[model samples]
Target: MAATNNQDLESKIATEVGHADVYDEKAAISDFKADAIEAENAEHNMTVLQAVRAYPMASFWAFVMSCTIIMESYDVFLMGNFVALPAFRNKFGVPYPGHKDYIIETKWQQALQVSGQLGALIGVFLAGPLTSRIGYRWATLTGLMLLNIFIFSMYYAESLPVMFVSQLLEGVPWGIFIANAPAYCSEIVPIQLRAPCTQMLQMFWAIGSIIVNGVAYNYNSLDSDIAYKVPIALQWMFPTPLMVLIFLAPESPWWLTRKGRFEDAAKAVERLGRKSAVNSTETVSMMRRVIDMEKSVKKPNHLELFKGTDLRRTLIVCGVYAAQNLTGNLIANQAVYFFQQAGVDNELAFALGLITSALQMVFVMLSWILTTYYGRRDIYLWGSFANFVLLIALGIAGSTGTNNAASLAQASLGLIVSVLFTLGPAPASWVIIGETSAIRLRPLTTGMGRATYYIVEIPCIFLASYMLNPTGGNLGGKCGYVWGGTAFICLAVAWWGLPEMKDRSYREIDIMFKRKIPAREWKKTEIDVNDDE
Candidate 1:
């Protein structure tokens, strides 16, 4: 039955793509026969720089797929900014005793914010089954179409309940998108392009955030409610183009292979690699060998995520994501609230937020350049440490000093923190987790990690909101102390557990874990996957 399915797929793909020799060239094998494959075919893959010079279309499509994260970024920035808008507040909350502006009650605010995360948690668990069944391209398209409905709801919302439900529904697409997009992006590129391309998720996130902050800074102060609606309407711009482009994009090659569609997988590789049929055939063969080895060793199940070497990989992936939330980024999200608490005027606060997003954009670009030379572990280790020290400075400057200098210092530190966090943990966290999983378990492990991340993230979001709210905890900069301590712990974990996966292939990563190589030695130890195969 499987052989018949393979032949049917081969005929269809060859007819459509003109790659007719796919099946006749080599018989698919379940076992890893190292000697049968050439060293050049199995390893010695293109570097990030070389891949782009060779295949510009591959990079272009990668940038297109990363639009999923851009949508995720725009939504998060828009929601955080919405609470700071005068019109949104006036519509949702009671007016203050002496002031004209209104604010949501602390508890209701927290509930509204965390509801999206809860929805995301549900989406993360669902992504594995849906993406596996429908394939990556369709799953992403489905999520984007659903997200458009929810975005319009927020634009038209007149009451708190409607907006709350809208935010919750919005998060469903976000969870599914976040769960699957990174894996898809990583799979579509070569090993050299893998980390840099996946890191585009974070870069585009900062781009979306900058766009929202730029728009909100200009429109947030209008007397009418259209100020907020215009920004909410901007959400439409992202999905429309993404939907059109995604329709034209190919399904993940790795995903096609998983479903016993080898001919289709080869065509995808040919498209992505811009190579001849022979090279694409060899690439598909190599991936099939790795995937076969993985499934034969253990059943691909959710329970397996918590078993053996995978347990460690899963834990590290989850920890990296959780560390992203805990490292004072929660305060960055509450930029307007923090500025209001520090006695900065509303306009200046919005300007600072704009500048913060811009600086994050700069640092994310810097991260791309740095990753070319550095490993993921040391970058995370140093970035977290610097972030902790900055947090302490921000906390002291914010809590004790009441003058202009102190306020300026606090804001300065906040901007610097944003830059360092972007350079260190922000992009690296997503890249590390996306690269760490086996192809068969990529969706399940990445989803579980993100779900765990949101589990830790929900409380941090609420706490950051409460601490900065004038009617709530009002911790001001003092909230930094709590998160700073958390950053220190994350730093230690990175130093101890995270491995160097720079330029490493999925097959190499699998072999390293199987051999029980210590995390610190991953860089020094050479595992020739081609020779071992």
Candidate 2:
């Protein structure tokens, strides 16, 4: 009787548990699917985060490479201060007129500037082929060589024509260096920190400008010929040390992968990652993915920039960069003259040049901090908005015909606006350029962007001469119009065209147009690869 009861109870319990097992299994399947999706998402997030974390190290070396290039920007702008001084023009037999009219306002000076741009035009075209053939490392070295040769030659260049030729040759390297540096920085830096790293280079360029300005200011006061010659000759100093250092620096692993040198590329990636001699499966996998992607896509030409999805992006890049050049900053390469027009003494003008350069560095640092913490869009928008307000204030101040305290206040406001100009769009423009384009298209896109920059700058520089000419009507008001017009355009572009790329991965940005995500929704939108599949 006991065994019969036990068997009956066991049978009942088994029947109940059998139904429970079916329910449990169904639940488990659902959980497993959800978990798989979560795991993939987590894995993707980790991959992107890792890339972000790895950016600083890679960008540090690239920053060092950039120092070499920034020296060129220094040389370009330093002329503004030096040309205003008696030392440079007098020694070189170039005439130095009063403040509103100086050697820089002359036909020869205009030619020199134009020649540099002409060389840049050619150099931009040459950079792709040269970099493609010799690799970025050697291409940079070639640029350094050209820069050094020109710098050393500038010391002995007796006539305007000779100086023009030297400046023209200098543009080749300048174009090559600027063109390739962005791609180099972009390739080596992780996507998350790409904006900051590239912007850091711009900051350094500003720092270079400061250093050159300060040095030129000091040399300007000196009576010796060596004052100008020494500073100009020092141009060779940065490149040699940079070349030696970069000789040990790892070449871009992406470039290596492009050339089909997988083993060498692997080694470079290892060095970039600061890993031991062991093989990196992750690096290899990324390399393979990149190579495969390159193989699958059709390469775009310059004309393609105006058609298809690329057209919108190209236009924005062009507009932003053009605005950057047109905003009177590069034109402010003639800052010394502007100061003199403001009735500042020559010594004070040089002093102010140094101060302005230093202040720009400070603002750029603030910009970097804001960029890292605040969103790119906010900084860009606020920058333009503030600039617009300041420009309007300047216009009002100029219109009042007041040279008293009110005039000084307006001038101060203008300087502040210029500082904001540096802090805001100047650095932001490059970051946007780096972030928006695909890696394969970076060179062409940056080339076009820079081409727009120079093209716009050439005309602006010429126009500035006409507007600020003492003989012209109401020079201050005319200059105000230029600034005011630029400020308005920047405001409009920031409002409508500029995309918010902050915290978004390059892959996400790559899908921006394809998915047609609005700029405001960029950060909040989750890119769904499965939908395309």
Candidate 3:
């Protein structure tokens, strides 16, 4: 009996030892996988961050792009402000109430607005094919030349019609640059930093407005023809340096790829990536992957933007850009003129314009910071909502004939709204433009989107002029109501339809929206290489 009991105890101890060994092996395997995953995640995060940080060349390219865009912003604001410039009005022979030669009535103002828009429409429509054929770099250079020629021509114009023709020619370059610059910035930067870099374009636009107003104010005070002539002549100086500088810069890698120059494209990509002087296998592999991916994708045509697979993307982009233009932000560009109509002095009004533009620049930078952490949808919703409220307040203040103090208060509130708007949709919209479409489709779609934007903008420009006419009697406030309504529509679209793009790769974004990949399973999915290559 004692021997049998000892045998049972020995057997039980052996069984327990066997189970312990099995558990240890399993635990070791699990720990190894966790470590591997953590390492991979860290490496991936580092790679993305490094790519973003090493984008100064791309940023420089973007800055050059912005210089041309700054001209556009300068032209828009300067034209509006020039309406009130004593030299401009006097040379054009705009009549006062008792004067005989006063042909500068509301109708002429409306006509000038229409003429600019008509030229813009034609120019925007022409930009798509021109950009595709000549590349954005050349297109930008050509547009800059045209812009300078026309802007300088305005200085010699003796009549309103000649000046009108100058503005009309100016619109062509204006339309082309607007469509091209955002596309250039989007293509140059890595996916994660797209929004911030694009927002930098907006930053310069605000700078341009400020500079225009500042120069105009100083020029307005001078008694000589040099006042108007110098400011207008200075427009020629704006884009020539940038065009010459960018001419020295390399063309976009993506554009090279599109033209089937793979080797050159790879070198361009390497330069942009700023890889070490000693090339590594990993850098070569990464660039080859980008090139191979470009080769595999079907290239998009301009007409295909309105057709199957890309139609939804096209519509969303168009709607967003249109809303951007129509939301009355451009009206704010003319804010000094608006205040002047409300009885503010020219110096005080220009001062207020400078303040508003400065605030816009500040908020655009702040918005760039927010975009790094938050989802695009959240920013768009909150920003548009704030803009909605502020527009209502401004409209109310306008309708009630508020005093200078009250107007200042309303303007302050409007500045806050502008800040929020910049923080939200303004920057995000550019990001969405890049993210939503296939790589091949991006340029054409961006052009189409911008075309729609400018098309919608033309009507809004004229409408704002008509509304703000003192004789229009409360229509200006009513236009603000329209802007508020547009903001509301944008909010609804954002909540129900907008996809979350934060932290997603361009490939991941394409898969999610274009391929209908389920949100829950997206993390588990991987892109598979096609064996055909």
Q: What CA root-mean-square deviation does each model show from the true structure?
A: 7.7, 9.8, 11.9
Which candidate number has the best TM-score? 1
Model 3, 110-133: lDDT tens digits are 566556656666676777778878
Off by over 4 Å in 2: 1-56, 91-105, 276-279, 287-300, 402-407, 471-474, 529-533
Task: Identify the runs in model 1 with alpha carbons over 4 angstroms from their true place.
Answer: 1-45, 98-100, 276-278, 297-299, 530-533
lDDT of each: 0.80, 0.67, 0.67
Better of 2 and 3 by TM-score: 2
Candidate 1, residues 1-533, lDDT tens digits: the string is 99999999999977866543443334233223433254234344555566776556667788898888877778777778878878778878887676668888787778777877888898898887788788888888888899888887878888888888888888888898889878888888776676677788888888988998899899877968888888878888888788899889988888899888999998887777656323676677777767876875544678988888888888888888888888998776667667767777899989988988888888888887777568687788888899999999888888776788877777777778876788988888878988998788888888888898789989988888888887778777777788889888888878888999987777788888888899999999887645443
TM-score of each: 0.91, 0.83, 0.82
Given candidate 1, what's the lDDT at residue 219? 88
Count of residue pairs whose backbone atoms collide, per candidate: 1, 0, 1
- In model 2, the Cα lDDT at residue 253 comes to 77
Worst 10 residues of 1 by lDDT: 27-36
